[model samples]
Target: MQRRRLLQSAALALCPAACEKKRRSPLPFATLADLTSMIQAEQTTPLLLVEHFLERIAQIDRSGPRVNSILELNPEAKTIATTCKPGLLHGLPVLIKDNIETADAMQTTAGSLALRGHKPKRDAALVTRLREAGAVILGKTNLSEWANIRSPNSTSGWSARGGLTRNPHRLTHSASGSSSGSAAAVAAGLAPAAIGTETNGSIVSPASACGIVGFKPTVGLINGAGIIPITHHQDTAGPLTLTVRDAELLMQVLAENFTATPLPDILIGARLGVLRTQSGKHPQVLALFEATLQKLRDAGTIIVDLVELPNAREAGALAWKALLIELRADLNAYLEQRGGDVRSLAELIAFNEQHRDTEMPHFGQEFFAQAEQLGTPEIIAAGQEARKLAMQLAGPEGIDAALKAHDLDALICPTNDPVGLIDLKSGDTNERVASTPAAVAGYPHLTVPMGFVDGLPVGFSFIGTANDDAHILALGHHFEQLTQARRAPAFSAG
Candidate 1:
């Protein structure tokens, strides 16, 4: 309460009239385009915008509802806001997942105590792009410890350094992660948008659970350097935002040579294949999916039903093996080059053991130990082979085959089950998700709000072939305009 008061005072000091109105309005929930227009109209300055968000973060995130999404605030945020020059995202503040690096006061620990004070020598490549595009590095958000790669039984949003990030829509429910905080913060209006990384469901699943838009671009589209590694083959950072256009704007800034070609009529005569096999078993979720299909049909899109990707199981298994192998190789190189006190995967495992009570309170580091064991030259070579085969099965032979056979522009499915109860002992109950095929194939996947089931939000996905991000975005943008499905979180207890 005292913190909230201080933030309120800060807002009033920043801009008396605007702050008073902002306090009573839904400015926190405003879209990027809305904020940009306000900035251009001289209604709000960058400093004032930062102060307003700081107040929101204090009121709900820390005190009132206690969403616990942000891990740390960028101490220099106000200063940067005042000085940042005009660009596409001028004056916008964006929260980043804890796994991504920022050369600032905030630590990029990936929500682990192992690297509690670790700071990168420079910002991650995407962070650099965001700064160049005139965005304020608002803070680092809590994430599943080590991107939910530690244990099979680990909770989705619980992390040693940042604790658990709860769903803003329902406090008791899970904020599906490893991008939990990023999604939740945006949903709760702590920030307009946030950056989340995905090797698989990290971005889209959480966005689905939080009622927002999550876009995972083709893996190589965005630079992966300086981020804490998972697997270079499938890892990429993308935007989690209130709208698909916001995601597209960030993508333009993050991915070089990328341009947003507005296709207001792209949905007309478009062929979208429905991946029924990937849709979950929830009755209401399925019903909502069917309703969404009908809405697309009404919008002149041709829906191809029962279009399933081939060899998904085989591709997933292969990708798992490859990720385990690559985790060791990729992480070792990153930690060594970063010059951290804990410098290798082996040392990181030992650090967890040393801090077992805090770091392993909910689950163990079995995945890290397994990766460490698979570190032979021959095994590494075999893992590379597995990665190659997995890409083939998931990409050319899977998503590509399905699209070609149906002459589809993209594929569609449910992004995830509804937000579940947060169970630390049992871990995440996300048994069914549509993130794998596109994730393994290193293709573009975008999830927008479909509708709600008993007050909990679900997502509709658009999966396209590699480098087909623009078309996929166009489809999502059109759907977003058609349905206007996204609603601001009510911060209710369910």
Candidate 2:
């Protein structure tokens, strides 16, 4: 067991008056057990603990890596702390992907300068559950501008309002979007945990970029209300955390239907599919994926490597098109309710045109143009065809048919390549990942840390059908316990 070491340098000790108060430990950060114990002992109130996190937010976020991934900070965090209890998460602080909303003072910018001042009128239903579970809604983290669907050239974590989010590993690599900020913050210890939504690989890809466990629940598991629009079929909020227990902790809060437990030996022995076709990730990542298969096989898992996924890329493209069309309608309706200004996507594009200095300094809204064209009858039919093909390729004919044909508990793949260079003008050029297929199916996928490459972390994704989220989470938990694959990075004291 990695005995959670406490590194209490003078730097960590440079806390606000809140963290500087008398304490047995001088450190600014604590482990999962440490946090749970602190809450259990009442040694520190949830309010004070949240204050510590906010202090860290002021200290490290955007200051160090200039990892400008956070779109906004929740101003009503203190107010949320006042209503805490013990049965639920009990005041653990968490970051929300910018696309999701809380009725806090923070503006939900979705990483675009166009909607800079839009405030969600009320908590998204999932935010309601987060509060009910006693978790502190810390703030909104930055994401790919429009969740990376706006433009293929869009930088993963570079938002006009938030700037570019730096990778925790090298400080120069891309933190894969569109859930870029959510993954970076949790890995950097900016928060104990965070929430992220996915239309494609948004959740798991970023989680892979910054070493953390990311869970995208079976579609509809977490309510999508108040989340800035994407494809409703695919988008849902899930947990990104340092440990499987923490991932389970957040999932329990978000879903009305899930219970966490380590799977039994018989369950571990269940057939597992080793996807052989995903050849896009790095060599180290492929090695890690193979290593993971070896671990499971050694434990008696019936590993099947010959499984086929002919529809993977085609389905992925379809899912992207579906997202664009859905985003147009969903966003326009969301904007209509706001009603005071910005009423349509056209207006938003116009606003960005007016402020192109901030929003388009690096890349143009080519995806927005693509989306704007989707509403036309010609493009609409093409979108319909894409949706049908996607459903056929990724859903019943792809992951489902393959998993069933092989009789597998879950399917594994390299989620994302290790950290790549951050390019604000060109965006993430070395991008490659395997989160698209499962994401398109609206199935649940859990990404646990696989291993590190060049001192950078990569992850393996375990994806399963919608309602079987618990099974995948349990399998991931087992792997996490067996391998324990994570190491905190040290700040370069140059």
Candidate 3:
């Protein structure tokens, strides 16, 4: 009751006019379309909207539930909201994952204490595009430390600088990562949408767990420059949003080729290969997936069952080897270009060792240490081989092969298991994840809320071949329309 009173008082103080308006929105789960419509109806100003969100962050993130999703807020957010011009996004507030650079007062730490005070001189390429489209850069959200590349036994969403970001659905559960904060913030209504980068399960896993829309565009659809790196081959940023329509709008702004052909009536008679190998273990998740497939069948969709990604397991393993080699080269290059004190992978490992109390409280940098052991010659040769084999096995021989062999338009599977219990001592306990094939193939993967598992949300994934982002997104949008399965989090107790 005291927390509720505090939140009400803060809202009244910070947004008096909006709070007094009889018909004003009370929840923070506004989508891009909802905000644009509110603006069109003269119901809200961008600055007022920004204040509402900031106040919500203060009330919920810092006060009540303490989601801890946001790390550093943009001090200039109000000024940006006041000055932003009308465009695709108008005045939508966007929270970026902390790894993405912004040439502002906020630091890009990638949730690590070692890079705590480091600031990049320029915004990441996607950040620049988003600003150009008239979105206010609200702030940076917490993420899995170093984008979850520091340790093999690291907990997802637990960071030295930002602490642990909790699941909004039910506190004390994992939000999954390395895009944990982005998903959590969007789910909790702290932000309408957020930018999340993924290498493997990062984006889709979190979005699924948080019960929102996560779209990982085909690698190279959006430029990855200026973002902290895990691997250049697989790292790409996309949006985590309340709805698929919002995802499409954000993708249009981010993708280099924005010409998305009008979505054909893809649902009716569309052949979708069910990735039988990766549908996750949780019975509730499986039940929800089965129900979702039934919906597709009722809508005239043809299900291609028993579809398997050839050599998928082997390819996933090879992809990890590729990431280690790429991480050393890619991350060092980024660190050097940013001109930070920790300019190399070796120095970063040393700094973490020196700051053991804070940086290694829960996990050590075994991944970093392994990455540092490789010389450039071995890194390059191994990276080339791993990338080559993984791409072939996951792409043409994996997703593409299944699609062609079954005459399918796309592939579908469970995005991940339900949100796991947060266990810092044992680290993240996700046992069933279905993002590897798309991640390794450099393909577009879209995960939309499918249904719930014991009141916790789960999602279904749509995977398409490279540059088939529009098609998969269309499929997801249609699925979202048919199911309308996403529900706002209940903010359940620990």
> Each model's number of backbone clashes?
0, 3, 0
lDDT of 3 by residue, 1-494 (tens): 45655885797799888766823563588898899888778677677788889999999888898888999899999889877877889888999999998999899999988787777888889999999999999999999999899998999998999999989999879889999999999999998999999988899999999999999999999999888998888889999999988999999898888555557667899899998788866777778788889999999999989897788999999998888888888888888887868999999999998999999989899999998877579677987898899999999998898889888899999988887789999898865778889999999999999988887888889999999898888889888989999998988886
Give me the runs in candidate 3 sitting further than 4 Å from their true place. Answer: 1-19
Q: TM-score of the candidate numbered 3?
A: 0.95
Quote each prediction's TM-score: 0.96, 0.90, 0.95
**Which regions of candidate 2 are displaced past 4 Å?**
1-34, 265-267, 279-281, 491-494
Clashes of 2: 3
Model 2 residue 117 lDDT score = 69
Model 3 error, position 398 (Å) = 1.1
Cα lDDT for residue 272, candidate 3 = 93
Please give the ranking of all candidate structures by TM-score, highest first, separated by commas. Answer: 1, 3, 2
Q: In candidate 1, what are the lDDT values of residues 1-494, reduced to their tens digit?
A: 45755885897899888767754443878988888888897677777789889999999989998999999999999889878978999999999999998888889888988787768899999999999989998989999999999999899988999998999999999999999999999999999999999999999999999999999999989999878989999899999999999999999999965788898778899999999889978999999989988988998999999997899999999999899999999999988998767999999999999989989987899999999999999999999999999999999999999999999999999988887799998888865778999999999999999999888889999999989998899899999999999998888876
Residue range 1-494, candidate 2, lDDT tens digits: 11211332342367645445524331343655568777677566676677777777777775755556566777788777767655567777778888776777888768777666667788888888887777788888988877776667777887777777767666778778888888888887788788888877888888887888888888888778888877777777888888877788777778877887655664456777877786464677777777877887787778788678767878888777777887777778888886646888888888888988877888888777767766877776777788778877898889898888878888877777776677776666856777778778888989988888777788878888768887888888778877788767544221
After best superposition, candidate 3 residue 360: deviation in angstroms?
0.6
> Which is superior by TM-score, 1 or 3?
1
- What lDDT is reached at residue 290 by model 2? 78
